[model samples]
Target: MARALLPLALVGAFLLVAPPFLDLGWQNALINILIASLFALAFNLLAGQAGLLSFGHAAYFGVGAFAALHLMARIEDGLGFPTPLLPLAGAAAGLLIGLVAGFFATMRSGVYFALVTLAIAELFHSLAPHWQGVFGGEAGLSSMRMPWGGLIFGSLIEVYYLTLAWVALSILLLWGLTRTPFGRLALALRDNEQRVRFLGYNAHVTKVIIFAISAMFSGVAGALQAISNETANYVLFASGVSAQVVLYTFVGGATIFFGPAVGAVIFTLFAYLVSDLTRSWLLYQGLIFVLVMLYAPNGLGGLIHQHLRHRGQLDWPRLARPYAQATLGSLLVASAAIFLIETLAVVFSRDYAVARRDAGGGFPTYEVFGLDWTPLSPVPWLLPLALFTAGLWLVLQARHPIGALWQRVRAGSEPGVNPS
Candidate 1:
């Protein structure tokens, strides 16, 4: 009973705490986070569990959104349907399309499977603009949310709750599915497809079924997005959407169930809040992805798990000095790189040139975090360069000590090892 109630308690706590802190804009961002989480979760189901890398999952997502919009339009025109049930239309569409597409796509595996999915998605993307009657051209389809069950869906708060409920239900269902026999078989197939085939299981059919189910959930997310935005567009079918889900799942830790959820929340928040602050947000995101791939391939969740698993064995007092030094050195190197990049960017940017002209200056001083320096100044460039060199030297000097400490920690954390 305690174990069963833990999840409920956590969710209840989240529901209580999440809304009050967020303004309308942030509440909307939260909705995006929920939707993105579901999409990433669906992708993880296939990629993480079934070992099927799909590069065209966005095709199903777009189809669902378009289907939801069409349903809304139809209902508005006189078809009897409740507004709340519209997501089912999207789910059905996604499932049907997934069946057809998965049949052919699943016939191939590995890179061939990925390429087939990509081609299918691209085909839909190309057709969406030309099939203006159905796709509503570039503008896509828009519909107003009608009053249903004494709730007006006009306010942000209402929409947030509605999305939250659907997301919660979807997550529960997906989690439940993971505990079923089919889920175990999917895992087995992922680990050894030939063994599953030898065991008299139709691996191809299993893959197709899982693919369809994954697509169905992706559709649900897309449907919710359509209802929230009241529009669906060709951009939904773009390869970038699929790529974003892959990034979210992989970066969050595909090995764990909630890893993609963590990734989705972080990615959505960063995109929402950080993108407005800088035009180089994509560069930062790419850098993060590169770092994660290089240093923590299992992702943020894996890193967290590793820390937790080894926490008891970690000699914090002994390790802290080196860790702090290494961190400081790394930060200095990163800051230097950022400073150089920003300075060069400002020097060449039209916006900066205009700002400089407006300031009536020969070389306009740039201000960042209360520090003012001219982009053309040698001092600005030389200071960071010197810092970078020093930091790099310090890092090199500390590498052996850090490496030895890390190995010791790993050895101590091993199951059979004696910490002493």
Candidate 2:
């Protein structure tokens, strides 16, 4: 109980502190963070806990959003209810759809299961635009939030608080699920389904239940999004939405309970920051994902967990030199790559051509980080290439020392091992 209360307390503290520091625009962004966090958590519940990789979770989220929109439309016509309870409509829609979809999808595992989910989502995505009456075609649906009792949903702060409450509730519920017997079984299934089956568990049934539960929460997130925006669109059903949640969950470290939530927060903030500075934000996201996959497969959470687990065995003095070398080498290589990629992207862009035309150009001079160099000039290209090659060589040279240090740490972590 105390362990559970800790998260609640932390959330309460955050809710108290965050809004005062942020302006209206940032407050709206906070709402997005809450929604995305919930979505990522829902995805993690299945993929991380049950070892089921879904490529179509957005279908449930979109369905829930549409359902909530319909409900709000009805409520506008004398169906009396508090605006706060709107997410329940989404939850119901997600649960119903998840039950139907999971029944068939959960029958398969591995890549087949992922493909099935993707197909189901794509089916909905295709139908949503054409189903004019329900999905509202391309324009989608719009509904106004009616005042419920004394609490008017007129203000952004009110909506933020409401979202915060739902987010906290959802997180607590999902965390509680992880501590239950079913959660243990889900972890078991993730490790070895055959062994679980041999132990008399019905893996199929377990999977469907987990899938449905995950969808239920995802629907709630979609519903909250609908409420926050006062509209729902076909974009909600897009594959990109599903992909975003998956990326967030994996990058946050799906194996940890709060990993996806952390990932969502970080990714959302990073995107917000990068989008303002560059049009090539997607390129940065891709780079981060690639680097994380290569160096830290378990993600930020996994990296932290590893350090904590092996803290006692880690020889700071002995390993410091190699760690620094590796880190510096990786940074240099990444910087060089980023410089080269961004320069190439700018050189080939239509904007570059337009600018050239406007300037009556013989050739375009690119100004990057205070350095002005034309693409036709070999100096700009050669500098980055040389730096990249040097960094790569440094990384390779440091690899042996880093590996040896890691081996020693691992050996020291074992029982009856002497560091000396």
Candidate 3:
């Protein structure tokens, strides 16, 4: 776990400096990663550590997000707390709701438990759209920055740092929770509920506690998401969101401490990359998930850990060369593909036809750099298409040698083989 913490701490430090170097696109990507990672960690507390699988954890998350959004919107209207610390109130609401729900749901374990949670999620999903006063109906709730120590989060980058702070605090607390005696007891409860009861431990209360803690973290995540996006809707409570959270945690390697975080980064980057390339981006996400599930049960992070353990000693410096090469190749291919696809869309757009028919049409003219064109020429589009294909080939070819070298190095043929 300490080994895991080192990498995470370094990553957090890097994030502190990342905003200045990145544009809005990358900052948005990081925000997605942070939100997903927090959500996964919350789910893991229930499913991975406590042996309680929830199909509707999004109930807490959605409620929390809505709670924060409502608070932000109503702060001026004099109904809720200030926006900066809104997550605490949101978490409190989730905790209270989780406790009530857990008491009723934990009466029966296994499939019954999952069903009860799912029903609760469905109930909330139905209510959000109808309860216009609280949920904002179809339009949802939109929020603006409230006064907070003279720091207004008007910029997307500002929201990213705020989310980063929330993520760090939430993860730290969850990590510490896992090290406590109560956490150990929860593990025991997971292992054998009957045995735990026989030993005089109240298994129901243990589960309820775990459920509440999980809900609390989920609420924090939701609140951060609400702040980042400034929008809360009924869709957040949908079954799809719950399913995505489950998939994210499971595919990331739930058993390991930091696996979910690694999974979040990979999943977010893949989504952004795919959505930029093809209209049917979901198909690509499904395919990647299926492949990861089949080949890497422990997830990408787990695979790395397993490989390091096999070497008897883990060293960050050793991974730099191969990781850098692989990462560089991936970025190059992804960028080229996105550039080609977006350029082609403009070059052959129906908007171009409309524009040509009426030069002063209501439709905005397409432009890039300083050139406003009625439509892009085929010649300009072809250059990028050709380059994209070449980049794809180069990246694929580059990875082969890197992989071979890493395998040989990992197999003990390399020097500095610290057989510690």
Model 1 bad stretches (over 4 Å): 1-12, 316-323, 352-372, 386-406, 412-416
How should the candidates be ordered by lDDT, best one leading? Answer: 2, 1, 3
Q: Worst ten-residue run, lDDT, model 3?
A: 368-377
Q: Rate the local accuracy (lDDT) of all candidates.
A: 0.87, 0.89, 0.79
State the displacement of the C-alpha of residue 258, model 3, in Å, after optimal TM-score superposition.
Answer: 1.4
Q: How does residue 137 of candidate 1 score in lDDT?
A: 86
Question: Candidate 2 — worst ten consecutive residues by lDDT sum?
Answer: 3-12
lDDT by residue (182-270, candidate 2, tens digit) is 99999999999999999998889999999999999999999999999989988898899999998898888998887898789888988
Q: How many residue pairs clash in each candidate?
A: 0, 0, 0
Which candidate should be chosen as best, given TM-score against the real structure? Answer: 2
| Model 3 pairs whose backbones collide | none
Q: Compose the digit string of candidate 1's lDDT tens values, residues 105-215.
A: 999999999999999999999999889888988888898877778987888888888888888888899999999999999999999999999999999999999999999
Compare the candidates by lDDT and give the number of the best one: 2
Candidates ranked by TM-score: 2, 1, 3
